[model samples]
Structure formats: C-alpha cells, structure tokens
Target: MRQLWRFGLEQAKSCIFAVVIFSALAITQFIEISFIHRYDFILIICLLTQLLMLTSKLETWDELKVICVFHLIGLALEIYKVHMGSWSYPEEAMSKVFGVPLYSGFMYASVASYLCQAWRRMDVQLMKWPPTWTVAILSAAIYFNFFTHHYIYDFRWIFKAATILLFFQTIVYFKVNQRTYKMPVVLSFALIGFFIWIAENIATFFGAWQYPGQSETWEIVHFSKISSWLLLVIVSFLIVAMLKHIKGKDNGNYV
Candidate 1:
C-alpha cells in the first residue's frame, strides 16, 4: 500500500507541466478577457510555466530541447489534421496558423515532459530493447501514418501489430521508493494512452478544442481514440528511449 502511494506521488510529480497547463485551461474557461484572445492567453501562461520549470531546475536544458522537438512535431501534425478536418480550434487567436493555435503544440510537449520527468524521477530503464534502425523506422512510419491515413488507406492496425512484434520482449523497470517494479512496455503505453484519452475529454469539456461532434454540445470523445493515443504514446516512448540509450552509451551505462 505504501509503495503504491509513493508510486502515485512520483507520477503526479512527473505531471507537473501537464497539471499546470490543464489548470490554465480550466481557469481561463470561466474568466473573460478582452485584451488578449483566450488561446493567446493560454499560450502566454504555458510559456511562463515552462520558463518557471526551467528556472527552478525542474527541467534541464537537454530535456527542454527534447520537449521543443515534440512541440514542432506536434504543431506540424496539428496543422495537417486541422486541415483534414480531424478537429479544430474554434476561437480566434493571434497565435493561430492554418487554424491551429500555437499553444496547441505545448499540449504535446507536456506529454514528452511527463515521460522525461517520470523516467528521471523513477529511474526508468528498458530491457530487451530493439535495434536503433528498427525503432527509427517504426517511429517514422507511425508518425507519417497520422498524416498519410487521410489520403491513403490507414495502416494503423498494421503498425500496431508491428509495434507489438517489435517490442514483445521489452520490459520497463522503474524504481519507487526503495523498491523497483517492472512492467511490459506495451502495457505502459496502453495505460498512458488511457489517461491521455481521459484528459482529452476534460480538454474538450473546457473548450480547449472541438471535434465536429462536440461543436453543438460537449460529449465524451469516442473511446476508439484510445488506440490513436496508444500509438502516439509508443512513438513518444521510443524517441525518449532512444535518447536515453544514446546518452547511456556515451556515459558507459547503456540500459
């Protein structure tokens, strides 16, 4: 029981960036501001929150770089998806480009931030990790599928099968308190994806963005979105894992 409590504490700690961003979303929902658009306000808040995390030493410079990479990657996806009518940012904002608020990228960055913080705080390591080339190819395929699916036949299921086959032997070991715990890498992806799905519901409820179905009235995001999030989480994990591997190899401590 105590170990579970400690684990939860660490997970919450790892979500500091996400929590702050969500809080800003929730708070801005009720307050009216005339000077700045709500999306722009949220963007400013996110920027300040990130600056605080950096200045307080909660996030390192290298980790910030990784988070920035995710931001650009996410922004690109957001632009394409919105163009494809996947979803939309309805409100007007100075920071919007091609109908996506610039702040939207930070949402994706928050996911990377969580992974980076959790990996650090919980002393995470991977076992039976696949080769770099295979992982890179898989990551690229998964990412591009998010775009190409709109034009061509969606290969998500095939990619999902590939992910399972590739990482079937992989295990994640994370430390909690004085005890270390292990779980299958696939299971971790599913769990994180589930929570992110729940967060999506909350974000929509607060009017962060809207699906066509939600434009009339807010409703639960389709549960099927979990699979999408699962795939995304896998890509996020693979990127972070590869970075860890490279760093570890340099430091003579490859996991």
Candidate 2:
C-alpha cells in the first residue's frame, strides 16, 4: 500500500513544463490568424501535469481519495445540469460513458488546485468572523470568474443557481473554525481558481468552447486569465466544502 501510494505521488509530482507548453500552445492558437479549428490538449495536459506534480508531493496525494469522490459526484451533477442547460461545453469535447461526460479530467485539476492550496494553508489559523472573509472571497472569485476572458456569460439565474448550490456545498463541507482557516481556505481557492481560468482559456482556443463574438476580452495585467481564476476559485471552494463534509462525517481522509 505504501509503495503504491509513493508511486502515485511520483506520478502527480512532475514539473510545470507541460503546463507551460500547453499554455503556450493555447495562446498561440488564440493569436495566430485564420479561423480554422485548433485542437488543444492543454486541459488534459494540465490535468496530467498537475497529477504528477501532486503525486510527487505525497502530502497532496493523501487527498486522492477525496479528490476521486469529488470528481465522481461532480461529474454526475454536471451531466444532469448540462442536459438541463444549466451549463454546457462543446458537443463532444469529453468522452461520454453511460450517458455522462467524462469530467474526471477537469475535476481532477480542480481538486488538485484545492489540495495544493489547502496543503499550503494547513498551518494557518481559522477566523471567527469568516462570513466577511467568505463574502470577500466570493466577490473576488465571482468578479474574476465572470470577468475573465475564459468564457464569461451572464446567464444570470443559471450562474446564480450554480453559485448558490456551491455556497451551500461549502457550508456542508467545511467546519466553522475560528483560527488558521482563513489563509488556507482562501489561498487554496485562489490557486485552484487561477489554474481553472487558464484551463478555460486553453479550451477556448482549442475549440472545446468559445465566447460569443459580441463579447470583448477583459485585459488585466499581461495575464488575461485573472478573471477566470476567480470562478475557478469558487469551484475549488465547492469541492473543498464537499470533501470537508464527507470526510468529517466518516472520520477518514479519503476512503
């Protein structure tokens, strides 16, 4: 068991070279002239790269069980939601098995970002008044999530419902700790959001999805992905909240 765990850790702990290459390819596509479809494997590459990077860090690998469960539940929920038009993607960017889009790849990346953040924030203290903090985090995340060049659409009620569901999921997952929680929770979400936004931009260029031509890209610094990171941050929180709930109930880390 220990050997297997160690091996998995190694797999998830590679370098960021793949992520860099993937992003470069993606941005290249978005910039090069012409309108032909571009094939991009950035998200998948990012997923694999993150997995290896994470596996190399056994501490992060410890969250694998939780990560797997989070993806399973999320894929199920998303499949249902997509059918209902709550959200969507390119018709077949993901493999479908048993009437569901195989979203484990995306979920894995999302989970990894949170795991990275949580691991980084482990030593901090939780706050007593987390509401203010949570809201502030939410506001920042929301702003960037929608404002970013990834795929900002104001489906108003659609997003509102999704955000509400995510917020409740947060409550269900995390304990109301008064100390050491703030930094870790917020930072974890922040990093996850960051990667997610980049992943979205990659997808847009790859033909996995696209924004309506009417929309204008929002520029922030040299890194236009800031806004998208904000939304990804929200996703990280939802996943963390769910994991916190499940793990707390079972008194186990993963399975």
Candidate 3:
C-alpha cells in the first residue's frame, strides 16, 4: 500500500497547475452539493479525485501536443454532439466534473498521461510514423473498430480516425525520423481515445445512457478500429505543431 501511494504521488506531480485549478472548483462543487443541490455525491467525489490528479507533473513533452489537439477536436466534437442530442450527461454538475461541460478538460488531461503510463507497462518501442509497417498496423486497428462496439453508438470515431491520418500526413511533410515514434509519447493520446470509447460503450450497453436506436445500423467495434489511428497521428500534430505554437516556439503562433 505504501508503494502504491508513492507510485501514485510520483505520477500526480506534473499537472499541479491543473490540480490547483480543479481543487478550487471542487471546493465550490462540494459546497454546492452540501448546501444547495442534491447531486450524485459519488460521481462528485470521482470528479474531485480526478482534479487532484492534475497536480501531477507529466514530463511527457511529446504528449503535450496530444493533449492540445485532442482537447480541441474532442471539445468541438462533443459540443456538436451535445447540441445534436446524440447523447447527454447530467448538465447540473457545474461544468467541472470531468464528464459534462468543462469537466471535459479534466478528461482531456487524462488522455495522453494515462496512455503514456499504460504504454510503459507494455514494455515495447512504438513503430516509427509513416513507415509502411506502422501504416499497416494502424490499418489493421481501423479494421478492428468497424467490427466492434464503438461505431454502434458514435460515428465520431470516423472523424477521429480521419484527423489522425491528416495529422500523420502533416508530420510526413516534416520528415520526422524513426525516434519520433516513441512508445509513451504516441500512446499518450491513443489510450485516452480508447478509454473514452470503452467508457461510452460500457455506459450505453448498461443503459446508463442510450443513443437513439433508430439509427440505420449498429456497428460498434468493427467500425471504430481504423479510426483509432487518428489519435496517434493527431498527437504528433499536438506535440509537433500545437504545443510549439502555444509555447511561442513556432511560426504558427503569431497567426
């Protein structure tokens, strides 16, 4: 147990700024729950814990790009989705619980960081980008999506996949070398997408929420497989393009 706590503490050191921000919000949420509203206390606690996790500094510089782009694309996509009533989560959670509204940012923080840690557990080097083999494996993963639970509920998987390819093509123009495809760096974003996909599937399957069943077909797993590639590719852009720009290290920052 001591070892576990130590490991966890080491992990939470990167996003201290995010944690501080979220903890402040969490206190407000706590007050709202205790004095004003009768909400899901369990879910609120989960949200608070996630926010606390932001105090952890993540040194995955490569993943900075993944977080930046995924947050933009996922936020855009989620806004559109919520607008369309494609699905919904409780809206009263004060926009800060990692589920609806701005808590989405917390969810975004979890993506690349979670993936980086998980990939380290895999103990293998990731293949270089734009290589024939990488493309081949990515293609196979795409194929796997179409046959699974992902597409059954959300076609956004298609959008995710397309963005990944675009991100990769953009990277190709830079002539990125083999070492750029480091394992944790690439997996940082990929794992986040996968977790979102998995959570959505589990929730829908259990009737936590339901997408309109009137859709013409329900192709979940097989549908989302290939689109998974977009995540890794998009991360490349986030690290290679977005973060550099954000940090004033790129030509695009001025624009």
Candidate 4:
C-alpha cells in the first residue's frame, strides 16, 4: 500500500504542470472576462503560472530554456499550419500573429515542461543510446515532414518505422523511491503520445483551437492524429534527449 501511494504521488508530481495547463484551458472556456480577449486572458494566466513555478524553484533554468525552445518551435509550426488551413484559432486576440496566438505556443511549451519535470523528478536515464548525430538527423527529418507532407508524399510511416528500428534496444530507466524501473524508449514515446492526443481532444473541446469539422460544433479529434502525436513525441524526445544525454555523459553513467 505504501508503494502504491508512493507511485501515485510520484505520478502526480511529474504531471502537475500538465494538469495545471489543461485545467487552465478548461477553466478559460467558462470564464467571461470582458476586459480582454479570452485567448489573451489564458496567455496571461499561463505566463503568470510559469513565472510562479520558476520563482518557487519548481523549475530550473535549463528546463525553462527547453520550454522556451519548444514554445518558439511550436509557434513557428503554428504559423505555418494556420496558414496552410490545417487548423485555426477562431477568436480574435491581441496576441495573435499570422493567425496564431502567442498562448498557443504555451500549449507546446507545457509538453516540454512536463518532460523536464518528469526527467528530474524520476531520475530518468537512457541505455544503449543511439549516436547523437543519428538522432539529430532523424529528428530534423521528422520536424521537416510535418511541413513537407502537404506539398510532398508523406513519409511519416517510414520515419515511424525508423524510430522502432533505431531505438528498439534502447531503454529508459526511471526511479521510484529506492527502486528503479525501466521501459523500452519507444513505449515511452507511445504512452506520452497517447496522453497528448487525449489532451488535444480536451483542448479542442475547450476551444483552444478548432478543426474545420469543429467550426460549427465541437466533436472528438480524429484518432488518427495519434500517429502524428507519436512522431511529434519523437521530435520532442530528441530535443530533451540531447540535454539529458549530455548530463548523463558528464556523470559517467550512460553510454
């Protein structure tokens, strides 16, 4: 029973930031603050919440840098995707640029924040890690495909297969109290991707963004998007991996 409780507590601690962001999305939908755009209001809440987390030492400077990088990367993708008519923000907001709101970037930053928190809190380490050059090349291709798919044949399935081929031997070790547990790195990506898809559905329901089918009425996001999330998890994972791998090397604990 005590072990179970410890497990639950660790889970909550790792996920608290994501929970807060999702709750903010859900809560913003019901708020009728007339003094500002709803998107802007959410932006204020998210920024302030992030600041609070940092000030309270819940997040480190390195983690903040990772979150910021995701924010910029996500914002760039948002601009292009919105322009491509893949999805859109229907509401007007002062913080919007090229049809993408700044707060939308925070949504992506939240994912990076979760990863950073989870990595530290759980004492995660990688085993049989692929070469950094290989990871960089694959991650770059995965990110490029997100944009190129509209204009060219989508090679996401190929990339998906590559992820398995490359990392099948890789394991991620994480701590639970004095005990340690491990899982295949690919499984970690899939699990995180699944949860992100679930969160995406909730975000859409809360009017965070809308698909064309959802322009008139809210509906569940397509399950197929889970594959996209899986690929994106790879991208996000690679970025975080570089930082963790460096630390692991410095500590002489990883290959």
Top candidate on TM-score is: 1
Write the residue-wise lDDT of candidate 4 on 141-172 in tens digits: 99999999999999999999999999999999
Model 3 CA RMSD to the hidden true structure, in angstroms: 10.6
On lDDT, the candidate that comes out on top is 1
lDDT tens readout by residue for model 2, 62-139: 465555655665566556545554335543333554334454344444454445444333322223323434555554
Clashing pairs in model 4? none
Candidate 2: misplaced stretches above 4 Å? 1-51, 86-88, 91-94, 98-108, 129-202, 211-235, 238-255
Alpha-carbon runs more than 4 Å astray in model 3: 1-69, 96-100, 119-124, 131-196, 203-210, 213-255
Q: Candidate 1: misplaced stretches above 4 Å?
A: none
Report how far residue 115 has shifted in candidate 2, in Å.
Answer: 4.5
Model 4 TM-score?
Answer: 0.96
Candidate with more favorable, higher TM-score: 2 or 4: 4
Question: All candidates: CA RMSD in angstroms?
Answer: 0.7, 10.8, 10.6, 1.4
For 1-255, candidate 3 gives per-residue lDDT tens digits of 655564455445433434443444446444554543323443354355544443443335455445555566556545555555655554354443334455454345445444444333322232223433444444444434334434465444664555456334332211112122232333445654564566445433432333555233333533353344344334433443333334442544320
Candidate 3 Cα deviation (angstroms), residue 217: 19
Candidate 4 runs further than 4 Å off: 1-4, 250-255
Candidate scoring better on lDDT of 3 and 4: 4
